[model samples]
Target: MPVAQDVIRHAAERPSKLAACGPGGELTYAELAGKISGAARHLLRRGIGPGTIVALALADPVELLAAVLAADLAGATPLIGDHTWDRRRWSQVTAPVGPVAFVGRPLPYAAGPPVRREPRPEDPAWACFSSGSTGRPRAIVRRRASWTASFPHLSDLAGIGPDDVVLVPGPLVSSLYAFAAVHALATGATAVVPGRWPARRSLAAHLAGATVVHLVPHRLPDVVGRSGSSLRAAVVGGAALAPGTREEAGRAGLHVLAYYGATELSFVAVDVDGDGLRPFPGVEIEVRPEAGSSFGEVWVRSPWLADGYLGDAAGPLRRDRDGWVTVGDVAQPYRPGEVLRVRGRGDGAIQTGGATVVPEDVEEVLRKVPGVGDVVVVGSPHPSLGAVVTAIVEGAPPRALLEATARTGLDAAQRPRRWYGVLSLPRTATGKPARALVAARLADGDPGIRRLT
Candidate 1:
């Protein structure tokens, strides 16, 4: 794996190239390289090196990237804990790994000299925690080399370059942010990240000059509606981009690419020029069913897959003897020898009244409901039918009108059984709704939850 020092090597050769533009403002490659080196020196002075995990609790985008690069330079594994994570949670997350240095707070001087260590291709680079299957956060492991493998493609395939200004409207702690931050650095592109993704302001960043935008589909509709920006391309992932939204973006002259990948396989499948998604160069894809539009599991073998999950008994998601992996995303063949159509996440399937339904498929229909401003369909636990379908609406709607509209688009068993309304949906860092959080609100019977319109 090329260490942070190697990334710096590129910066030294092109010092004046624009490296980043975050809340900390714009920085040249030289300045960014210097920050990384300075933080590396700090870690080295603290006697931390290879295999060590450092907890980063700050929200500053540039500083977060710098600290991550610094850990790589020091040959230490950096665990990117959320800035909003409580100190107790922070302590518990870093408990398995070695000592952790909190990035934002001032640190005490080391009592010992620096330790020098080298990084390897398989060595852990960062540990990103996700609210796991049980709703508690668990670390998702990645290596430094995995990121470097996809570096060249950032410029070649993703249309990111020195002149491109890439704005990522999400937390740096998230895997997508980590990938975008590093990709911007590798390509010498300017990265613009907000402390939080304020929809209107995020669109303003693009209108101001951002050429590339990393966004979720939910936010894309609002972003597109808010600004008439000169955006050439948008990289949308983390959720489904409805056909309506894609058509809207097309009308806006913005190329909307529905990226299919996850934390496990960074930038695996990308669709360009509004074509269906396809595997990148050097990446191999295998479809399980090899049949019609009925989706099957997608397995990937790429040079960029992560090494393994740290301390977890279960192995990395679907790595075989041939180095293939699958994160359980379900897809169907879109076009012959062209691209695959991502149906929805495997775990998000809902069985309502003994009939199977995917919420994303249902949500696509809900998005088209005339009075529906925003909506999320989920399976509410039921005593008789296994799980009953429920719809959360955000816009003005009479319950009967929405149900009538939705019924026309969905099958009898697939339509939502319960309808509810809320001022807003609970969202993750990227403004995508958190099902668990939304469920909690529904369970609490908050007055804000009303009959769906």
Candidate 2:
């Protein structure tokens, strides 16, 4: 069944239940159903029908949710775009999927004929763009079943129910938060979204009523500092959580659940403890070892995999004849229960003096150093070594302190050859470090970089 139908079912059974809430407004199940019906009629009148691609650029979370459902009800595939996108970036992203219509705000309720088309399980449901931190973002398409199929397992794992209120503090443009909101609505839970980016005040207010929250690891420190409510669970992903960060979150009264996944593949492995992640129920995992390396590229086979990218950029979604797909993340099985220890992305591996260095390994060690807030390890150009491991730190700590910490924690090749301190590091919308931007700044000798040689 289409996800919209779930909302319709909820409206029939629980008309007075809160469906969504935000600073701008709140919606009961009945009200949300009415809005979705009206929006569907409006979309149909505008000539948006089956197979049509509609781009929604709205910032309001409630309105965005309604618009997406309405598009699906109208038999149209919704492509959600960030309203903050500038002209150049927007054009680069939407160019692949040819535009049909753009809706930036909620449409008026029209008393017109109801949309009669029913979306099949295989029908295209939604399209979301990649983070594009490495390059231009690509549009990824997924079928309705791709998400709904995993709802039961995910809901069980998340402990979501009708009484639960799920807080999604990030923008709808991010697939992570988008999934949180949609999954909440689909499962009869109330989705609480923030009105704006940064989401400090909005998050605090919603946390008072929210039972669960979706957060990126990098944002956890700030959120834990501000949040006072004791949540049942906090879902953290998008980037690796630094050492001691989970413990700090626990001290703040939040139980953290970290998972590893990609845009192409939905939820792959979920972190059971500090060691690594255990595969999601029913999901198959395999680690194909490289010729001369202990770590292997991680492959996943699951019902939640996306169909493919919308346009010509299809090379990254590598698949084999057996229906298994990989996003180039390298890992190894650490336990018998299908647990995996992710090494790093194969593309991000750095070759230095005939040795391979995963930046995440160095970053993990550096994060344990005192006074270090955040760290991103990258390869910088060197005279002898092809690339020297460099560490970019958020706060300006003495070189002696970092060097001392590295001496015991890291191997000789894994140690950072140079350190640059800055007030902050560049990050994507989802809070992952913007490696490309950081590399450019370092290469161009940005004045903000304090060289601790």
Candidate 3:
């Protein structure tokens, strides 16, 4: 069922219960349902009814959530517009939607015949912007079941209840936060948006009334550092948590459930505490390696993968004949129901001296070294070998620790031959290394990066 269906259901069960809390104020379930119904009716009035594709340009977090739910209520697929995107980027994403209806902000609630409609499992639900490290983002269109099907998995992982407040620090435009907000609403838990304020550290400073918080690994420090927090559990997604970060968060009484998922693949795997990642509930993982290699392209079979790219017809999301999908990620051979070690994207693989090396394999090992803030491993052109493994380190960490760790933790061919240190590395919105910008800098021989060896 569409997530909007749950919102409507929750209103009848707990009309006076708090639904969402933000800087503006609070919305009880009845209020949220009323507000969402009003917006949906307004959208219907504007000809954005069943199956219509609507682009939401709301700035407020609460407004964005309301608009998204309202769009679903009206049985239209909602695309969250990014403020950072240019006109060209916007056009590129919505091209396949075909004559999209634009909703600048949520409209005032007006009483009328309910526009509520139950969305089909395969019906277009919403569009998610890919976390494209390559600088180009594709709007991945998701189906109603793709999201609603994973609600049970999320509920079990986070252990949220009606009284529990779920905190989403990031903007709703981020697929991670969007999922979190809707999940809270669907489960009848109060959704908390205590970030995006002047300080921006509002999340680290205060968690509002959140008992279960969803955030990326980068925000763990601030969240753990916050005093007088009512938070009991933290769910970290987007990227793996570093050893130091996990330990630090553990010391603060927050054992993070770090999830590894993508815009195309909803919840593939999750690592509880510090254990290795295992397939999420109802997800199957397969690693197809070369003739003799241990690491191979990771393929996933899930009940909730996205419907595929919307705007651009060309992308990496591939679904094979056997119902398995892959976004080109490479990983070590996975044992069913056990630890799955993902290396990196297959396209990002490095072949140096006939040996294949995944940058993520090197990056993860380097991140474990003390004094190493961040690392981005890439393949640089070499005369003899096709390409040599290279490492870009953030901060002037002593070269000895990096060198020793690489030699001990990695194979001879996988160790980075060239090392460069930067005051800070270029990063994406989610705090991951900006592979495209870094590769461009390396290609241009940018002097801003100090060559270590």
Q: How far is candidate 2 from the true structure (C-alpha RMSD, Å)?
A: 11.1
Winner by TM-score between candidate 2 and candidate 1: 2
Which candidate comes out best when scored by TM-score?
3
Off by over 4 Å in 3: 84-89, 132-134, 195-201, 291-293, 346-453
- TM-score to native of every candidate shown: 0.70, 0.75, 0.75
How far off is residue 92 in model 3, in Å? 4.0
Clashing pairs in 3: none
Error of 3 at 59 (Å): 0.5
> How many clashing pairs in candidate 1?
1
After superposing all C-alphas onto the true structure, candidate 1 shows an RMSD in angstroms of: 11.3
Q: Relative to the true structure, how large is the alpha-carbon lDDT of every model?
A: 0.67, 0.77, 0.75
Model 1 lDDT, full chain set: 0.67
Misplaced by over 4 Å in model 2 are 86-88, 132-135, 195-202, 223-228, 247-253, 272-275, 333-336, 346-453
Error at 406, model 1, angstroms:
24
